[model samples]
Target: MSSRPEAAELGFGDIEVGQVYEIERSFSATDVQAFAAVSGDHSPLHVDPAYAAGTEFGSCVVHGILLASLFSQLVGMRVPGRHALYLGQDLTFRRPVLVGESVRAIAKVTAKSEATSTVVLNTEIRSSDDKVIVMGTAKVKVRDQVRESVAAASAASAVPAGAARSVALVTGASRGMGAEIARTLARRGHAVAVNYLRSADKAEQVVQEIVAAGGVAMAFQADVRDAEAVRAMTQQIVERLGPPTVLVNSAVGEFANRPIAELRWSDFEDHLEYQLKAVLNTCQSVHPLMKAAGAGAIVNMLSQVVGGVPPNGLADYVSAKTALLGLSKAMAAEWAEDGVRVNMVSPGLTRTEMTQHYHERVFKMEAARTPLKRIATTADVANSVSYLAGDDSAFMTGVNVFVTGGQTMI
Candidate 1:
């Protein structure tokens, strides 16, 4: 084993913004299997060929969230280490990543915060071709010696102080899990940009709820799939809701229900276009702002299925979700030194519209078979997402917390 100090050992005095922290971790088919065994995400895109062959990609791919787990290692050990607290991250999957592929995680600190003890990182994930498969921003709490020494000696240290509210642009806030996620953030007192594709009514309702519940929120509509639109949306959110320091990517489409054989290439790309590209567009759009502000958080939703899942019809769905995992890890590596904490939450089966149909057919069996003896609720997943998005999980990044309830033991 290499004898380098953990990331926490590296002092902030020796680092500067824009410095690159590039690292490589080889992931094998067995590694993926191991992750699946521990995470309970046994989706076929990362495993079964019989299920993957009929999909548009025509090949099995690695689970996106499994790749995302690499982010924790990058942040917790490779880049920031002991001094880091994972604030949040935003991720986009640009391409399909297959098993046995050598992937790299790249991190660059783009922003730093003295008062909040944080940094914002610009992150990227690439394959051997140097093609970016995933991109996102990670907001990390770095130990600022100036602040630490002051707090340690100050007599008023016990007084509760209000730090500046951190914000983020979350897509797909019309309803379902995205809305719930937004509400969770608002309840945590975060200022939020409730992004909606076409659900103005739903988005507005969420806004009203946040306001009524004594939280801050605003509704903005953007088809996150469109790059230009995402750019415009981020700008609007910054103007309206203050610069977004945290981003939670919870957007998904209803088309995720079908199996691979019945899946059309257009349907596959459409999902990719909206779910994956939307994240890229938003992160890229907000990255400069996060850097300029000196801190930010980005959280991308990854599924346990990306690692391995029982036989299900969703080859394309699994492929896209699997791709997301790799993207999260790459960003965590590239952006950590810049003061950004990148991490991921691989949620097990959760009750959401996406799983409504699956719930009817397989959830009962899934719950019965699961060690937890129940499917994960939206709250179950959201709690972890919120923690990663806040100071509660400050010492984390480039890590994937398997919220599988012992489905996978690793």
Candidate 2:
């Protein structure tokens, strides 16, 4: 560790918009070797001087990713400090960085979201000669250390015995966006029911993680497409956690993007079962409980594809998701008098286990199309869900919030 003070030591509460931080370091040949050894990226441009000498740079150059890694150090150690999660980043390489060149990395807070405890920073790296090597923007989630402590103390003093917080049921929460939403709710003092279909072990793991973090969570298994199963699951949650006042319909089935010409009718049915039918089952099952409570929030997960379906395929998936948008609006209108608010969150090409196989291609395509120049992450979608599930959006209903990095503006 360099003699630099950590971000936590500097205190995040003292940070402000436009505040800047800088760190200077030089990447040595030894550092390059170590990076190569650890990352398995021993390319001729980085390691073979003989080959590198014939290239345009005329010398070995440090890996671009290696240079970008400096931004991580700047954010975690200098700016937001200890409790920071690097959510997303957009980088542009201005010039090649050669080993042993002293470089300065700078981060400036451009925007801050107090509701989410996240900050967006402008980032740049320059050589000692003042030549910019890399430039980009980064979004990081930081913990409000001081505020959290005060809130925790206040909550401890305010609540009465056996007075449980609101309950949130997140479906398909064994992993990906669902799991993160469950955890986020728990962190906000809500009792979370982690719903899963076949991933019992993974669901249990999510519960364990929440419990370890001092949050209340329990895993429940059910095939969301099955109405009977969903009803049983809701009953179990009611008995254990309490009636769920906030329900997030996030469970989805596998999508096969076959051309419309070759797609069979069953393909459409399959998606409907998972998307439309599942939402119907979950909503109907929880309607009574929420209606009786006099107030509740329901968040349904839709895909950005509904905005404009990709031509490559997924007609079945797109059709079903389009229907979900209408369903959300109808529910909002019908449930308004029942004191239940319904909303939708649509994400575009988010990084999740279901999309891992095509992660690289999808990321490149979506990032190029997105104005933010980055794909959405699980945390990004989770943050939107949290917003709609909480009192911040109490007056909002029948709205479709797109967490698509501006890919789907409508």
Best by TM-score: 2
- Write the residue-wise lDDT of candidate 2 on 1-410 in tens digits: 69865465444455666689999988888889889999999998998889999999888899999999899998878777777878777778999988888899999875543324556677999999898889877877677678556545554553333434688999999988899999888887787899999899999999999878878888999999999898778867765566688999999888876889999999999989978899999998787667645679999999887786455688888889888999999999999987899999998888788888884776898799889999898888888999999999999999999888887765
* Per-model root-mean-square deviation over C-alphas: 17.4, 20.6
Report the error of model 2 at residue 346, Å: 0.4
Q: Highest lDDT, which number?
A: 2
Residue 256 of model 1: what lDDT? 51
lDDT of 1 by residue, 55-78 (tens): 887767887777676666677875
lDDT of each: 0.73, 0.83
Tell me how many clashing residue pairs each candidate has.
48, 0
